[model samples]
Target chain A: MKKDIAKLLQRKKKQIIDLWMKNQLADASLREDLMSNEELLEQSDELVNALLSKLTDDNLSNAESTDFDDVYEILSGISISRARQGFSPRETGVYIFSLKDALQEIVQQELRNDPVTLYEVSIKISKLIDSFGVVTFETFIKGREEVILRQTDEIAEISTPVIRVWDGIVALPIIGTLDSARTQVVMESLLQEIVDTGSGIAILDISGVPAVDSLVAQHLIKTVSATRLMGAECIISGIRPEIAQTVVHLGIDLSNIVTKSTLASALKHAFTLLQLEVRRKQKETSTLKSNI
Target chain B: MGHFLLVTIQVDLYDRLALNLEADLVQMVSKTGARGVLIDISAVSIVDSFMGRIIGNIANMTKIMDAETVVVGMQPAVAITLIELGLPLTGVHTALNVEKGMELLRKKILVDGEADNSDDEDQPGDGAE
Candidate 1:
């Protein structure tokens, strides 16, 4: 009976070894599967199970400590190549996440050369995610607050900047800081508003501005140039004293543009330039004559 | 420095209210000397360009008064419509609620006061305000 028990134990050990080898083969196949089809990357559970089952006494003893950085380097190369092949941003995020997960598992299993190597892999993965253009309102804000915040920003930034007047007079009141990106957005929105409204006069009020940089000044000049091309008069208003000093010091020229110190002054100037005053007088005269 | 103006509009007379709000706001600012005015839109749901134009007018009027006017508490759908219609509120301040509007107005008042004080010191004979 003792001899029989010993033979059974030996058979069980051999079977376990064979099973481990089979699992290793399966893990290798799954890795190839993930690489070929991006969708398989989300199947993390199956991949993790396959990797765990592959460990055996002999293989574990012989396994060299893996460097997660090496794996990340390989993954980064593959991701860039895929991106060059026209992979979408979402696909790139998925692919990067998969590689990060695998590397994390290896580190957690204590198979990595240094535990700190995991942090390096994580940083690379984050950089890759940023490169994927992962900016959206939903990602930044949660629930109904997202909608409200976005609406508020839109109203403050886009809607409040451009005002449409009767007879094609568009006024934009600028406040706060004008970074490069925001400047671009403001330019595009104003141009589109002018086109849609067919405004003959575009007034930009910078009264609320505290300062102006070279880049912002450049954007303003560009906006004026474009508006002139469309046969529209661009009026700038609210030139604060400090901003004026900066513009002069920076050698930015505003020779061709019309400027005013206030929105009321700008509108009055715009009305005169657009020849709307004569029309207003004619209407008033007609009304007076009819009343008489 | 923060003042609230509640202008009630009957459902059918909303259009008239939009056309008249700017003139009314100008008169109010002249009377109150408040730094900010908040127009509550919690009662009205739909707003057209006429209303938007009036809001713009109020914004411009406030600048003349050396004050700021913010349209507050507009329904979400109305806000969306205003955006889609390309209604211009240039020079107009907007806020999600009355409290926020007050906060913005107070900040504007403080900043303007500081600027005026500095301008006074810079140009002694000239009236900066």
Candidate 2:
């Protein structure tokens, strides 16, 4: 009469924790690499205790009930941590669902004398645990998404590097497909380097670009024009043969841009523009050569 | 007219100021019989299509008056902005600094002086690209 399920679960917290831990350990997906046995015990014990304290017959069917806030918090914490620890979906799913199995096993034994009450309570608890499993999955995916977002940010930062290849020339070799945002970064950094180094020539080697569409061409043009605006000539080098075919096929006008077939040629052009010659130093024919 | 008119535009120019300068420059070139015009715009920061047109007009007008015109000391930012604005500055010659501008003008005058006794009519101007 006085919230019998919550009171019973609270009284037998130790029994539930033992059974839940046994169920997890006996399962084949138990990953000792991700979490140690002692850590798993502590986490399982804490979650089971929080859930039992918050459990009530009224809130059994409603996992989102305010009274279950502490339970939800503990559940989400475990879920996100497992996600970061590289647990598979099935491993994590088994973790939350196994707790339900242990609880149901205890519920069946505790309510064996009254089948009707047992059936209703079992249904309610099943729904509640199922919803908690869903919340676990949601938080797990959110955690994974955060990791992916961080990786994307790192890629964007590292992909656009402007290198000073010569005393008065800079080269930017793009290794990925160019989007508008990336193109903007390339242009800003190139222009900044031009101003800093007083470089008159900037070489953009886009041989790594996979395809040549109109949009990619437009971004390239914008970057080139931006470089030129700095009163520096921009030479686009490393135009692959297929990319050249696509450019002509698309009728994209790169007439104003100076394109080279390789980075070496672009460097040579930069040297010519800067009036720099890479001369080979003659070896001193030593009088000591006779001693040798 | 005596040697060459050196106009150093130190501030951002408006339409009226630019047009007035162009008109005065043409008249001065003819009145003084100057051989070249050097407009130092390294400090003038802003340029729109209208300003680009005015600069082009000055170059063309001076050329018609038998004087070569050179734009010198254009800042990187200004050049970038002008290029983005679709003005490639094809009509007039551009130099990195004042010294280069003077050398360009001197070479032009030398070519003209040797090629003809009197400077002939100007060729049609190439518009902003």
Candidate 3:
């Protein structure tokens, strides 16, 4: 009976592919913009071939059997690629279940004379396809997570940049929350830049930071201490008014570290530390104006 | 190497090595009458609480001997670890590199010398003046 079912599926391979394609195209959620019809047909053909070529009586009821490895591999590949291509989970799920529908249709037609066999074969096909659906979703989610993780790493790498604002001074503008991990990155990069530039002063601009809490305050203190240990003065700037209120309320002592309300003031202080001044060309501009 | 004792810690310090360093550093300070001690720790990557305490102790000892202590070229990770360990090496001075450390030590010694000279001249029994 099992051999008969496998043989029946083998004989109707082309019919199964056509029926699956028709079912997918007929579905309202078909994503034509993301995938061309020919590409869809080619993917469906490959998956159908893998499934039918491996179908046997012994492995028909057990979806976890090794015989279905090729099918699972192809399904996961298609689903994962679809996930990266921005196909919705529903669309990917429909793509697989439609093939199940096609196989069921063929089995039902071939077993019309025997109701008992028809019921048994349909149940087996349903279980196998349901398991495939689960694998596809799993791979799809995994692919999406991979994309998210890569984006996070890239953000962390590019967010903490040390900018040299003067001959002996560097500035680092932090744009995110000051977590311990981010604080480590900020400290390492800032200290390394200070050494590279031989900057005696470092300005930490936190204008882009949204909030300041106790934990964040602790991380900031650690960074400042690390900078001081490197023999460079660390000036924290761009403290919002609310952040000031929060810091005071929390009773966190920032008295030892120089804190400025703006980057401009921080730069001015840094200039004074280096004994370097930025004066306007007042006399030259006045002479030119008088001549004109 | 001149008026200053330069110690470069090139390996991870254990308890015994750190203790030995503290004792030897004090002895050398008294023996050479060095005005400054510069500890270069750029090569030392790992540190523990015991090492941190030893560094603090060395700074304190050197300060008592009328010698300035400057820790130079401290790695960022090591600095953070030391800070988290609750040992800021408070009595110690710090510089970015060996050259800067030397400059700091020289300036400190020169200022102390000038202060001493001024104090001696202020006294009534100063024959050289």
**Clashes (N, CA, C under 3 Å) per candidate:** 0, 3, 0
Single out the weakest 10-residue window by summed lDDT for candidate 1 chain A: A132-141
Candidate with the greatest TM-score versus the true structure: 3
Scoring the B chain of model 1 against the true B chain gives a TM-score of 0.77
Question: Where is model 1 more than 4 Å wrong at Cα?
Answer: A1-161, A208-210, A278-292, B1-129
lDDT of each: 0.56, 0.82, 0.88
Model 2 chain A worst lDDT window (10 residues): A279-288
Tell me each candidate's TM-score: 0.36, 0.69, 0.85
Total backbone collisions, model 3: 0
Which regions of candidate 2 deviate over 4 angstroms? A275-292, B1-129
Model 3 spans > 4 angstroms off: A277-292, B13-18, B81-90, B106-129
The digit string of per-residue lDDT tens for model 1 on A38-123 reads 33332333333332344332322222324223333334444544444444445544533443344334333442454464454445
> Per-prediction interface RMSD?
13.5, 3.1, 1.0
Report the error of model 3 at residue A101, Å.
Answer: 1.2
Clash total of candidate 2: 3
Model 2 lDDT, full chain set: 0.82
Chain A fold similarity by TM-score, each prediction: 0.47, 0.85, 0.87
lDDT of 3 at A133: 95
Which one wins on lDDT? Answer: 3
